[model samples]
Target chain A: MSAAAAKAKRAVRRPVSIASFAQSENVRRDDQHNEVEMLMPVVAEVFANIGITKNDIDFICSGSSDYLIGGPFSFVTALDAVGVWPPMPESHTEMDGAWALYEAWVLLQEGEIDAALVYSFGRSSPGNLNEILALQLDPYYLAPLWPDPVSVAALQARALIDAGKGSEEDFAAIASRSRKDALSNPKAQVAHDIPVETLLRDEYVVSPLRRHTLPPITDGAAAMVLAAGDKAREWSDKPVWITGFDHRIETHSLGGRDLTSSPSTAKAADVAGVADGPIDVAELHAPFAHQEIILKEALGLDDGVTINPSGGALAANPIMSAGLIRIGEAAARIASGQAARAVAHATSGPCLQQNLVCVLEGE
Target chain B: MSGQTTAEDLGPVTTLATPIRLDFEFTPGVAQSRFLRGLEKGRFVGQRCPTCGKVYVPSRGSCPTDGVPTTEDVDLANVGTVTTYCVVNVPFAGQSIEIPYICAQVLLDGADISFMGLIQQIPTDEIRMGLRVEAVWVEPEELTPSLASVRYFRPSGEPDADYETYKDYL
Candidate 1:
């Protein structure tokens, strides 16, 4: 690569570290409270715990899909948290919270900003979530047919079954494991081990995918604080440094491409170098039970690696925020000396259509 | 998590009934407009990348890798093998098809990539992957000057393709 090309690439991939992180409890559906009110305590605690004020931040970015709120430009209403009176440089992507964090990391790498804030919110209880998610497909061909998320995932699950890689028993085990893990997480909405055998007895939502195979319709918000190398050291004694981050999107139509596996996520993981490095923990954003198995194979994680200490999305899953919180939770482990390195994965669209993978290390 | 307002404050539930007709007189932007205009006459089309010799179905406005336009007009074959598919059991608003229908990605002959369409003229349970399907054309009067002019795909009377051939696609 020429110096100019190398410089441009470096400009896009600077090592930013997580300085602070916080989140609200994921609920079945927060109908009583609005997004802003639900977010204030999370935002305030994250900043206050780090001993920083609004003035200390240089940039803010968010990830959200307007389709969640049944309205467009939903991020505009979130400006109240930043007190935009003294405005700020900000942008948003129609992705999950993890991608928003990626955008902030890119902006920080530009050398213009030392600190940034990333946040996301999603409320799925207001609508029929399974049906609402079908809109994520290609509007021209796939979306008009309205194949829900679970059915698409079931196709993948069936493929896994056909390929002899997984089965309904294995999927039930993942659900049982997640609910058991959620018992320790205060913010987890679905937190109980119902026993895999009992779960397997439940009726299918879309054949091969039982009701327990899906996460509840959750509404919640999450935020993470990022700072450049020097700023990171100043903010905390231990910082979780982002070493590699990459995201890739595939064609939106379901039938136009593969379904048994997630090539987009696998390619993204390869680009992000998740397979090359040593990972002690992984936080994968697999809302459906079966997706967790697919992402595990895509990222090439071993049995040695700890997965979803935050109980995974099957426990909480607040749509847009769930992905970003995965990054935040993974980074927190590294920052707190719980893990030396970790990989965080996020997915959007039907059956993991678009995916982002981020690698972080402790310094 | 910050600055996101509550449900009541989010605003009134204004259901937009806007008919989002994103009809573009797309000048192919870079590829062959001739192939696109052929849709007006209900023709399946593609364009070949001269340098790579790759025939892109719904021919690339630009090559996937080089980002260069494919200019030649290549009217495509109506029949192909299904690479993969999903039963769209759930229905959406403004949907033209019924539920429990099979939607498959058909790799039309001589094309580099597959295109999606409804698998018709067969039982839903019988819509297996790699099933040979021929394009069912719309009536001349119903031709819309778009991809939708092809009513759907039906069994092509060819042998069901062995799954191993398209396993990579799955």
Candidate 2:
């Protein structure tokens, strides 16, 4: 390759490290704290971990949904938690915090800023999340039918079973293992050691998905600080370097595409270089149990890879923040010496229509 | 030969209204709950920020500038100045009050921020900046943990506050 071509490629692969991460304790209903109150301590802890303040941060980006709060410009009120006075360069995404982090990573790659703070918060308990999520469907056709998230997910689960991709037993097994792993996670909302056999005995909330397979309705928030190069080293001795970061999206028309497979995830994984090296741990944002199976196959994760050490989203899915939490959990594993290399996956839209993959490594 | 339609053939169908309502159980959180409770007792309470020492009425849990919990509570006087206001000449839906009513941002004594309140018992033309006003509470029996306990604000009959006092709030 020409030297100029090599330089251009190197610029695209600039390293950004997750310097710090903190999340509110996942809870079924956080009646005592609003979104701003929930995020205050988490943001404080994230900055304090790196011995920095909001002043040290060059940019701020947050992810949240207006539908969750039943009001528009909810994120503007949320910025109060960050003390963004005197004005700062900021942006927001209506999607998950993982995508907010992606925007920050892109800015850091351009070498415009040294650090950025990314956060997301959601309270699914306040509203009928099933009906709220239905609003995201095609307004003309699907939204009028008001297919709740569980029923839609059940459709995907049934497709997986009929296509011979997996079974109800497989879904239960994923739920069983994820929740069992969550027992050790202090931030997890639902952590149990229930056996898959017992889970299978329970009646399905929707066909192919029992109550155990569904994620807990959680109200929580998460915050992370990303720094590049010298600032990253200053923040931590073992900075989890984001070697590859990429996201992809599939068509929003659910029936037009296959539900049994996650083509978007596969494409994101390829671009993110998930298979370039041995992945010791993989954190996936799979709110539904069977979705984990599909994501695993899409990402091409093998038997040697450990999945959802933080119990994944089955233990606690706080909508906009859960996907970002997956990235933080994966980075934490690398920072703690539990793994040298890790891959984090976040999905959005119905049936994994959007996917973001980030490859992290520690030296 | 062709499937074509002229504008004259099609009637105007420019708008489609899809009204949506999603109910939510709002939890006011620790800070707002205290402020709401104070309203029930016919009192104005504000929280003092530990970092900046700025008082926020009905504290939405933290100081917007400091991002820290305003733990210190301060009892505030009802009487304050109208830093700024708008005369609602045009009627809007769900507007119970008569047209040309005054809606003003009232900055209570010792509070750093201003809160919106309906200015009553005064001409819309006379609702100037720095006009002194006091909250009019609902009947004692109607008191509850809500801002609704305070019916509205009217001219306090006190002297207008100096512009220098609340210029920062404006």
Index of the highest-lDDT prediction: 2
Q: Candidate 2's residue-wise lDDT over A16-91, tens digit each?
A: 9999999998888888987889899999999999899999999999999989878778899999998887789999
Give the range of the ten consecutive residues with the poorest summed lDDT in model 2 chain B: B1-10
Candidate 2 lDDT over B32-97, as tens digits, reads 989999988999989999998899998988888878887888999989899999988898789898
- Per-prediction TM-score, chain B alone: 0.76, 0.87
The CAPRI classification for model 2 reads as: medium
lDDT tens digits, residues A150-239, model 1? 778888788778988888998999899888988988889898969999999999988899999888778889888898867888998877
Error of 1 at B89 (Å): 49
Clash count for candidate 2 is 0
RMSD of 2: 3.9
Query: Once model 1 is optimally superposed onto the true structure by TM-score, how far is the C-alpha of residue A54 displaced, in angstroms?
Result: 1.1
